[model samples]
Target: MTDLNVSVSRLSPHQECALHPSFKWKPVYNLECVFCQSTLCVRGMKAILLADTRVELYSTDLPPSGATVLVEEDYETRHCECRIKDIACALCGNIVGYHVMLPCHPCLKSCNNGHFWMFHSACVQPHERLDHNSNSILLWGSLPTSTQDDQMHSSDNLQWTECCR
Candidate 1:
């Protein structure tokens, strides 16, 4: 994977122009829930400035601005719908959840189990998440569950980790 840039760098001026200087892109990894094996939602991406392809993580306590972070790849032009903004497992980049951006939120299990999920609303089915419904709800940092099987990060004392719904 490419190195990450967590610094507050200059927003890609080239983001507006088709012609511009070459900029290196980085791959951000998402964290998944141990229970239900679902990807949890997470704070939005924070753009940072850097000298080169190397990435330097800043304060983790900082909250991400809730917005869609664009990537080097075009969501509609460069790839198919699934490849556009598909979310992947943190441990493995498999198609775990859907998103309109790369490294979308964590699995749903993370949310339903009270685990912190990191995802953009565009990444999942409309009916699956409660935030999208007209219920006038806000479930960030909270788990999204439809069944009793949903459990937050499994116990550390257990011999195995739970990461599925």
Candidate 2:
């Protein structure tokens, strides 16, 4: 059994939260699995938007601790022939996403480091840490925006009014 060897440095909290410039969806820390509510990844992480429903995380960004990569079967993407492995929730064994094993040249050019982990939007949810010392969390389907219309999306099964802090 191959387990994800997580370095403690990868999970360290950031001094300040910095949102990705292109994607203003949410701050990239304290994301949790939608099914089991286990923490997927946290702190100082950067993401690339593969699609409206998928987000990609670089290998350096610390892949989800609660997920494991299954190397049993290799699959290719329809858009690109990049080989990938399925990523499953370590705790619940639910297929959460995929990890890129090999990237074609074109994919490498656009994929920054040529490798990343992709998570489905519905499979994972983002949470804001209200206080570093406290366990309080503010959960939302989407980031709070200036306009009420864009404050939350119903498909994510989260609402701005459901804050737990």
Candidate 3:
């Protein structure tokens, strides 16, 4: 099999385009449910910057084939109150993340019109499929763990401050 060169980088704090003209795009990766290893998202889905322990997926992208959004429920984050639906693994029924139904005012711009989906970093694993014709996959190890020093470095530039705990 041909070797794939994947550049995985820590997600930076969100910045407005007007202030940061040269924004770098993070590479996309396939994600799988950590519990059952079922594919959650394929390539072409880029991770958006949220909190350190969550992975954000766009609502416009194809929904995960191995998961489903459940009924909406009230949820509270550190900074705001919102309504969200739990995203569970279809194969195992494990709660992997959530879809924002009603975002708080500060999160409205980031919510993309209720199209934001978040996956717990601990519940999903980032991976790469070696070949589309086969069932082979390459796990990318654990998601990035944030340290106090790292948090201090980027705290001033955070765009989306509200996050589910």
lDDT tens readout by residue for model 1, 57-91: 21111112221222344353132222344334343
The runs of at least 3 residues in candidate 3 whose Cα sits more than 4 Å from the true structure, single-residue gaps closed, are: 1-24, 43-62, 110-115, 128-165
User: For every model shown, what is its TM-score relative to the native structure?
Assistant: 0.20, 0.52, 0.50
Point out the worst 10-residue segment of candidate 1 by lDDT: 58-67
Give one digit per residue, the lDDT tens place, for model 2 in 1-165: 124221111211221133232333223345567897755544313456443226454232335332444646878877677887888766567877777788666775652422267666667776543322233332122223213322122312242223222
TM-score attained by model 1 = 0.20
TM-score of 3: 0.50
**Segments of candidate 1 deviating more than 4 angstroms:** 1-39, 42-72, 77-83, 101-165
Runs of candidate 2 with Cα error greater than 4 angstroms are: 1-26, 43-60, 64-66, 111-115, 129-165
Candidate 1: C-alpha RMSD after superposition: 17.8
Question: Rank by lDDT, descending?
Answer: 3, 2, 1
Clashing pairs in 3: none
For model 1, what is the C-alpha lDDT against the true structure? 0.27
Ranking by TM-score: 2, 3, 1
lDDT per residue for candidate 3 within 90-160, as digits (tens), equals 65678877777677666665523223666666777875434222334322211122132232223222211
